[model samples]
Target: MEHPVLIAIRRAAFTPLGWFAPGPADHAPENAKFLILIGNTGPEMFRRFARESGVATKLDAWTREAVSGLAADLGATAVYPFDTDPPWPFLSWARRGGAGHVSPLGLNIHSVYGLWHAYRAALLFPVVFDLTPPSPGSHPCETCVGRPCLSACPVGAFDGAGYDVQACAKHLAREEGQACMARGCLARHACPVGQGFAYAPAQASYHMRAFLGARQEE
Candidate 1:
């Protein structure tokens, strides 16, 4: 008998409120029977959930376990992670080697959340779905010559190598980041896509403070 577990996992992971809030792309699993969407809850949330689950010792391990469990239940062949180093093989292929460009909407062109979206877990099935991967030829950033995101930073937190987590946090800790603290995040909002995904200023400041450990001025 095929694994009924795979179906159960699919239902849980792809549901409207499932881990992956919105589905990304559809892929064919060589052995699995279903597909699961792992939602983005940010890095901290991922760690907390993993620790509580007790199946993983590290963030990556915990995520893998979560997706695997879902796939196993659904009789799927494999589970995949969307974020972190080196994207999934199929996703990479679909991206047509343009993985270096950050997505504008915080979601991958194939996904609704863009770069802001992340996968805490994944589940794959053996069955084939009528899903069509996004065209790897389309480049969203091609027309974005100004790169507002790079300029919107009050402290130039993004140094092209990666975000200066310390610098960003420190600035947000003080009154200088008041604008962002009162209204909404600047850098995230600067992106052309996923305007709705912008974090509220207070929320951004809270994250900045946590990352930088910067003390607020009295």
Candidate 2:
């Protein structure tokens, strides 16, 4: 059975990706014994986000607010990936929890959600729950390689080693990138891992536009 806390989070539209007990080296909250990584896997979260009437701008602020609100009820401290004041080690946390691995595109790829998933907030609780530990599933990028993600980009933005942000941004803002803009990331779409859990077209477009907007703001 899923823990009440995780179930509550899912009810609120966030997927609890995985969890782990923080080691001494992990700079977690003083009394935090456990951490549950949470994020969106598909469009349900986006649907909820869209339904909520807000000029709250980016999904970051909204996710932080939602998770923090839920955390309070569960007596947990909610930390976000967007928190930069002290900088939370989300990537390391994800790796430790076995929820993700660094993929060729430089994005964290989940065995279940592939490149379509993203870490939103992590819940830190003082007590550990009786939940099964996440297994480090077979990496999707490994075995049977015709890595289409490497060649899917029109501007060759993702080259396994690094991503060309400027080139990607320029493409996204132009007519030539309309297919990607209208649907989703070309490279992300090429990944066969979790196509079943892929984001819906509308949700994909929103993120792409948001990405382009953020690049423009930068």
Candidate 3:
């Protein structure tokens, strides 16, 4: 029994609006019926939609309900939220079950857009869609053995403990982060995949400035 929403998701995947990026793992449960691949909305789009929808007051809860409702309407047996932090217990359960991939807030090759990409939401359907996971294995960082991202930082913010957000904020405070904030967001540009996924320099600068300003406020 092919699900209608699953079909819609497949069609959406290839369309310009879908923004679908393939996942690394194959989700083939014996009872699995459909697979829905949802991609994150760009940062700009998220802001715009949130403002216009007037659901701004309840954005977070609204997003969850919308996804859950979509799954229920589609008759999906399971729903997976990719690329964002869901409840910790749900995340643990998903990991133990081998259902999907959960990415951190920092760098990843699969999404060259980097942390700048906003994961507004996602809804995975249990309808089988016959799509193959990305091959040649996952984790593009594996090929970047020297880990250029670690060295590219002007302040060594990405030390052994992932990204040093406070250090990065402090640096960006002075001279508006002349080293990495300008034409060289090192970690972001370092990503090999989705080179075309980069936000415009002006857009990047705006975000950098906002992030730096927010950090100063903190």
Candidate 4:
């Protein structure tokens, strides 16, 4: 049966990607009935909402709070992509069902949004809802003529092996990488699908700066 909470959750501006029951013998809260994978349109949409709300927190913190607020209204709980204390396995979750695939870039590529989207939150709810696995949307990587995402990185951050975090950060710190740091990853932009959903240049730049700045502080 369709749950009113799910409908309400969608109306609150989150896409429900996957639905599944609590695992066997799990010590999860008795009230938690299902795990719901949720995502937003993109970081730009989220940032706009944050700006309109007049929040003063950093973007990541602000986004988590905003999604949590929506979950609270539905008597559910929201956890973010950034959570790591008891680190959430969001990529694994997304790969398992109707969500999407782990791309050559070592990122989850949604069928509709490809690599251009952001997964803002994961929700746990106390209500029953659809248990059928969602259609794992058409994979763009499967039919691409040359798979440009594999070789588009100037620094080779993505390759036959996988994504190199340190290599990517080091490159972004250099003058040559300024373009990507200002407009988002070149490898990500090379994907054929979901160009329409790509993050705006300003939004991409904001995130790129934050990413590079965070690594330097470490």
What is every candidate's alpha-carbon RMSD to the true fold?
A: 8.6, 1.4, 7.1, 2.7
- List where candidate 4 sits over 4 angstroms from the true fold: 1-7, 25-31, 53-56
> Residue 137: error of model 3 in Å?
3.3
Output the number of the TM-score-best candidate.
Answer: 2
lDDT of 2 by residue, 1-218 (tens): 76788889899888988899898888877888999999998887888888884434678878877888889988999988888887998888988888978899989999888888899988999998888888769887887389999999999998889999999999988999999998899999999988988888888888888899989999
Over 113-176, each residue of candidate 3 has an lDDT whose tens digit, in order, gives: 4333433233444444444332323545545566666676777887645778898888777885
The TM-score values for the models, in the order shown, are 0.50, 0.95, 0.53, 0.86
lDDT of each: 0.47, 0.87, 0.47, 0.75
Model 2, 155: alpha-carbon shift in Å? 0.5
Q: How close is candidate 3 to the true structure, as a TM-score?
A: 0.53
Q: What is the alpha-carbon lDDT of model 1 when measured against the actual structure?
A: 0.47
**Best lDDT goes to which candidate?**
2
Point out the higher-scoring one by TM-score: 3 or 4.
Answer: 4
Each candidate's number of clashing pairs is 27, 0, 6, 0
